[model samples]
Target chain A: MFWQQLVNGLTLGSTYSLVALGYTLIMGVLNIINMAHGEVFMFGAFVGLFLVNYLKVNIFVAMAGAMAASALLGILLEMLALRPLRRRAVSDLAPLISTIGVSIFLENLALKIFGPQSQAFPAGALSGVQLQLGPIRITLVQIVILGISFGLMFVLRFWLSKTRVGKAIRTTAESIETANLLGINTNKIILLTVALASALGGIAGVLVGLSINAVEPTMGLSMGLKGLAVLILGGMGNITGAMLGGLILGIAEVFTVAYGASSYRDAVAFGIIILILFIRPQGLFGKRQGGRF
Target chain B: MDIILNQYYLQIVIFVLVNAILGVSIYMTLSTGQLSLGNAGFMSIGAYTCAILTVKAGFPVYLAIPIGGAAASFISLIIGYPALRLTGIYLAIATLGFGEVVRVIILNLKITNGALGISGIPTLGTKISKMLSSFGLSRFGGLTAQQTSNLLVLVVLIFILAFLVFFCTRLNRSRVGRAFASIKADESAAEAMGINTTYYKLLAFALGAFIAGMAGGLSAHLTFFIGPKDFAYHRTVEILSFAVLGGSDLIIGPIVGALLLTMLPELLRSASEYRLMIYGALMVIMMAFRPQGLISKETVRFWKRKLGRRINQ
Candidate 1:
């Protein structure tokens, strides 16, 4: 039972980590929380659904298309909305409010375009396969999700550590002004980072949609909140921190629900965040920076 | 025309007034460099307190409203002390958690009546006897029930509006207000200058909560109903939207925002199902175009200068 719950927790955590990675990347680069990220994830799932149901594409191809489309959309959003604001000397609140606005706008737009009803992706044999390893019974889709998520994380780790652009990104994350002085194209790096993050969000959305077999407009708000909590838990602006945070949250939630009441799941998650804030405000893996009011 | 000015319209107008009160309360904290996402929770405390006291304990309605408001203010003070120590996004998150916790507790508590919600308390319209008597009218004398209710609502709204205008003027000019402005500008600098950041932060939060609680009491009285749904996260978001869209710096901004946004769904009734979506989209566009807000006085001055240049050309 413990193992089953642990596997379940891991699968859930993997998806959360994917979403948190997106948040961490953007925050690391721009120092802005893109509230519309969850909406991007939701849109990705809708795109995946459309491809599978209407175009009869394979699941892998559909997910890939969704990720690509979401990335393009992220770039468009940056160009049309975020870029112009950055050009002007605006306060940090401006971007926060603007992103929130974008979040609302996209959610509403999605509702208008897709209608309010929850939609399911086209069903397949992937839904039927459940593997029993001793006392632990797990879905094939859960295993697949875990495997794909790890694969993506590995690729991302390699990309961040090994590439020139990756080093630039790291430098930008460290300090934007300093990175600019070092001859890095900070703007281009920010755009690239946002695109990459959005793609990850999209992939997570598709996986979550497939796992749950339902998609809706308001899913973004809850998912975004959870991803943010994970980001804080692991360590803000740290990819590895986000991963660890996600796993901790997932496992904590699973165990809490299993032992306690299901109603307390959300409360438990929030309680953990509050406790973390009180005990270690910098988060588990986040480096301590200069404190300000 | 008479029907148009009757009970339903009176109800909606009262609702608008209540929302306006809540909006103003939110504006107070926001202007002072703090964001408490727990406005709805404070409102709920006021609503529930008033309802429970008036109905169960049989307290006079006259007494209940102030007591309710005070209770909410005290609660805010407690939460604000520890929570406001954090700044910016952390404070927002902490308050958000606080709001959710309040909601959860209310949902699970036996006194709250849980999901079924407390119902069939004494109607709020009955409590306006003193005001009516002062105007040479007894309770239900020389007026229909609808007329009496409308008068009660109108009187309460006028009273609130007067209070808000007075409060705004005082806050915008006072030393404390200047301190708030300084905190908003730069907290460290404010501290360096010998401002008690902790005291002022708590003051802002408590004051906001008191106003919100009063609004909640008025809302419960006007509607003759109070439910958990009335003070949900969506309502908190809606209040934030009002403050954001209108311009947080000015006192009247929330009032304008609440009036416009509250009536917006009714105007767009044709697109009823997509109303929330449209509202969201409108907010995004507004943020994208005018992050400073719709009625930012600075932006207005800038625009005026540009227009003057065009005229000179």
Candidate 2:
């Protein structure tokens, strides 16, 4: 039973980590929270659902289309709402509130367009295929979710470390003005960073949709909030920290449910976060913020 | 005036007043240089406390509401110290977590009715009816006793809002308000100026929580039900928008925002499905064009001058 819960927790944690990456990346480079990111993820899920269910496309094609669409949206959001605010040098909370406006708009738009019901995937490996192991059974959906989540993180790490754009992104994170002085296009880097992070968010959306067997418009709000918690717990703006945070949060949630009431799952994640914020504030791997951000 | 006493208008007026109270709660913290998104949690605490007292403890409405506010304020005192230490987004996020955790605990607890919520809540609607009958004004609008009772909620709550407006205006000009302003501008500078930044921040939370608690008590009685879902993150967003859209710079900003947004959705009820869409778009456009909000002192002066000229004409 313990092993089974652990597997389930890992699967849940991996998906959260995937979404947390988007949050951490944006915070790392841009130093702002994309309050609408969960909506973007939800939109990605709808796009994937449409591709798979309506167009009868392969799952890979659906995933690609969703990722591409979400990436485009991320760019547009940065350009339209955030870019103007950043240019004006508004207060720190301005963009945060603006993104919320954007999020509400998109959520309502989705509600009107897609309707309020959850759109389910047609019968596939999602329901029928199961993997049986001794005392620890997992589903094919779980395997696919875990595989894709890890694969995306691995590729992201490699790109960040090995690619020119990756190094440029890091430099911008370190110091935007310094990166600009070094002859890097900071604007392009911000755009690329949003796009990459959003792409990862899109991938997580599709994978989670596949595992859950349905996609709903409201799916992003809670998931997005939880993902933010994961990002903070792992140390805000810390990549590897976000991953570890997600795993720990997921396991904690599972154990809370296993030992106590299932209704307290959301409460437990938030409680752990509050405790951490008070005690450590900087998180496990994060340096104490210098009050600049 | 007769139409004003009718049920439809009364309901809208009560909602406007309740939302205004919530808006002012946010405004209090905002002025103190903190962007707290957890007022809804405090609201829930007050509502549940009031609901339980009136229903289970059998306390009178007048007596129970104050106790509710005190309970919520005490809880805020506990949450404020650590939560106030963080700046900007971090503080906002911490409060957001608190709000969610509060909601979840309410959902799980048996005392809150575990999501079925507490219904048949007693309210001042009846007292209002009796008072109106005593004044012989019950016959003025041809309103039934029940309707008069309902409209009484509007009158009593509007008076509460007026008191808040007066209190806040006075608070803003006092030495404490200056402290709040300096803290908002720069905390270290405020501290260097011998302002007890911790005390002022905690005061803001305490006052904000007190006001939000009262609003919740009134809300539970007005709606006749208290549900956990009613105080979810959705409410936090609404309260935050009031401060955002109304402008947090001046005393009247959030109240104006609360009144306008609450009435806007209803006025656009013809569009029905497009209501939230329009609401969201307006917020974005408002922020993009005017992040300072609609009722800054400059704008207030601008409107007053325009109104004066019109009156002279």
Candidate 3:
């Protein structure tokens, strides 16, 4: 039972890590939480849903379509909501509220287009294969989910460390003014980072949709909150922290569902976030002392 | 007066007043520079407390309201110390989490009636209709029971808003209010100048919760039912928007913002589904153009000067 839950936890955590990376990426460069990121994830799932339903594409092709679509959305989100605020130099909270506007708009738009039902995720060939390894049962979809998530994380880490634009993004995140002085195109970097993060969110959304076999408009709300908690838990703006945080949150949630009531799943996740905020606001990998949440 | 006090119209006016009270509750916290998005949690505390008192414990409405407010304020006081330790967006996220926790707990609880929610509870509207009938005002015969009930709710809501306006103004003008403004300017600077930052923040948080609690108590009595779904995070967003869209700088900002925002959807009834989309767009546009909200410091000062000059005249 423990091993099975662990497997489940790891799988769940992998998806959360994808969403958390989006949040971490935006926070690293923009210094603001993109509250609409969950919607971007939701929109990505719908894109995949449409692709699978009409175009008869495989999961990988659908994922690519979702990534491309969501990247455009990320660029649009930066151009419309965030860039204008950056231009004006509004208060820090203004962008948070602005993203909330975009979130609401995107959510309502999805509701209008998709209606309020939970649509079936086209799992394609992955649905019928459950692989049993000794005492534990794992599925091909779960393996794919983990493999893709880890693969993407590996690529992201490598890109951030090695690529020229990656260095520029890292420098920008360190200090926008310093990056500007270094002659980097700060606006392009911001847009590029947002798009990359949103694409990750899209991928996470599709992976989660496949794992659960359900996709809905409101899927983003809870996932968004959980991803946020993971971001904070791992330490804001820290990629490795977000990964560890996602794993920890996933394990915690699975244990709660196993030991406690199923309804307490969301509460447990949120409760952990609050407890972390009180006890160690900086989180595990954060640079500051205990009280700087 | 007959046309104005009709049931539908009175219901709208009553909600306007209730939302205005909710606006002030959030405005209190926003004025202190803590953008707490958890007033809905406090509201739920008040609603459930008041409902249990009146429904199960058999307490009178007048006695229940203050007790409900006290319960919520006490909870806020306890939660604020640790929660207020976080700064900026972290604090907001913490408060938002608290609001959701309250909802989930209420959703699972037995006394709150779980997802089905508590119903058939008596309301202030019922009392008002009784009072109207006993006074023979129903002899005028044009006022239906619904209208009479709605009128009572309107009266109660107006009283609540009036008291809140007075209390908020007094609180904002006192030494505490100055400290609040200073904190808003810079917390470390305010701390260096000998202001107790934690105490003032807790005070603002508790006061905001207390006002929200009071509004919740009244809303429970007016609406005649309370549900867990009623106090979710979106409600907090709506309450926050009253402060954000109206102007967080002045006392009247949230009140006027609440009034206009509440009425805007009603006026644009032709495109009901699109109203929220428009509202969301408007928020983005407002944040882009005028983050100070519809009312700013200059607008408030200009009005104050104009009113002061008129008084002098």
Best by DockQ: 3
> TM-score of the second chain in each model?
0.90, 0.92, 0.92
Per-residue alpha-carbon lDDT of model 1 for B1-313, expressed as tens digits? 4576677667667767777888899988987778778899899999889888887899987788888899999999877877777777777766766676777677777898876667876666665755566787764545675677676767868787778878887987999899988988888999999999999888889989998887787777766677888887667877888887787877777887887887777667787666556556666666667765566668667889999999999
lDDT digits (tens) for residues A219-249 of candidate 3: 9888998999998898889898888899889
DockQ of each: 0.42, 0.73, 0.77
DockQ of candidate 1 (2 decimals): 0.42
Candidate 2's docking class is: medium
- Top-lDDT structure, candidate number: 3
Candidate 2 clashing pairs, residues 3+ apart or interchain: none
Docking class of 3: medium
TM-score of each: 0.91, 0.95, 0.96
Candidate 1 vs 3: which has more DockQ: 3
lDDT of 3 by residue, B3-116 (tens): 777667777788899899889998889887888978999999998899889999999888898888899999998889999988899999899888988899999999999988
Task: List, residue by residue over B8-94, the lDDT tens digit for candidate 2.
Answer: 877888789899999989999999879888899999999999989999999888878878888889999998898788888988889
**Order of the predicted models by lDDT, top scorer first:** 3, 2, 1
Clashes of 2: 0
* Greater-TM-score candidate between 1 and 3: 3
